[model samples]
Target: MSLDPINLAAFLGMALVTYLTRIAGLALVGRLDLSPRAQAAFDAIPPAVLIAVIAPSALATGWPERVAALVCGLAAMRLPLLGVVAVGVATVVALRMVA
Candidate 1:
């Protein structure tokens, strides 16, 4: 296997752009005087994005994964992000064992 210089440079360029966007977003948001309603919507973005990424795969996979997703969703209501992820992974493994 060979390391292609073009691919490596492309990957690094994309990573820099992504990083800059996030930093710029933070800088821009820091100066905004957002109302409570807008702030609430902004705070919800991370979890919404997390669900958007994970929900499709979870719903389309086997029963164990679906069940785990449900359990994870429930846990998310009360737990932090790390805890929620742990619960999801553990639930899937346990359910798979029983299946």
Candidate 2:
């Protein structure tokens, strides 16, 4: 099987963009003199971005997925992180199988 040149180039371009953006962000942040509140906000960016990315799919799907997310959130309150994740995954798989 031969690799297509266009696809190869596009993949490389995406990699380059991702690499540069990450480096640029690190460098910019390193140089900044952020206040305590600003630093806290910056730390929250990752989880906030994660929710932004996942919320759409979690809400758009069927009831099973929504219920799984809710169960996972509740599990997170009492279980270890890995245990919560396991419960969430197990709940979703069980719900999907039943459906």
Candidate 3:
């Protein structure tokens, strides 16, 4: 299949923007001396971002998604991170098949 020039340009532009933002973030953080509270907040970023991305879809979807998210949360309490993810995915797939 042939690549469309416009789509290729758009993809490259997006990649460049993503790369620049990551580099800029690293540079900015490297230059900063954060207070303890600020450092703690920065550390919370990953989980906060994960929830921000997951919460909307989990809440908006039907029972399968909600139940899967709950399973993930419960698994997280007792299982490794990979296991938690596996449980979540399995629950969703099983529920989807049943429905």
Residue runs of model 1 more than 4 Å from their true location after superposition: none
Which sections of candidate 3 miss by over 4 Å?
A: 74-87, 90-99
lDDT per model, in order? 0.94, 0.86, 0.90
Q: Spell out the clash pairs found in candidate 3.
A: none
lDDT (0-100) at residue 62 of candidate 3?
Answer: 96
lDDT of 2 at 76: 65
Question: Ten consecutive residues with minimal summed lDDT in candidate 1?
Answer: 42-51
**Clashing residue pairs, backbone N/CA/C < 3 A, model 1:** none
Task: Please identify which of the two predictions, 2 or 3, would achieve the higher TM-score against the true structure.
Answer: 2
Put down candidate 1 lDDT per residue, 1-99, tens digits, no spaces.
Answer: 999999999999999999999999999998999999999999899989999999999999899999999999899899998899999999999999999
TM-score, structure 3 vs. true:
0.68
Top candidate by lDDT: 1
Clashes of each: 0, 0, 0
> lDDT by residue for model 2 over 1-99, one digit each (tens)?
999999999999999999999999989988899999999898777656755776688799998889988997798679865686688789989999999
lDDT of 3 by residue, 38-69 (tens): 99999878757776898899999999999999
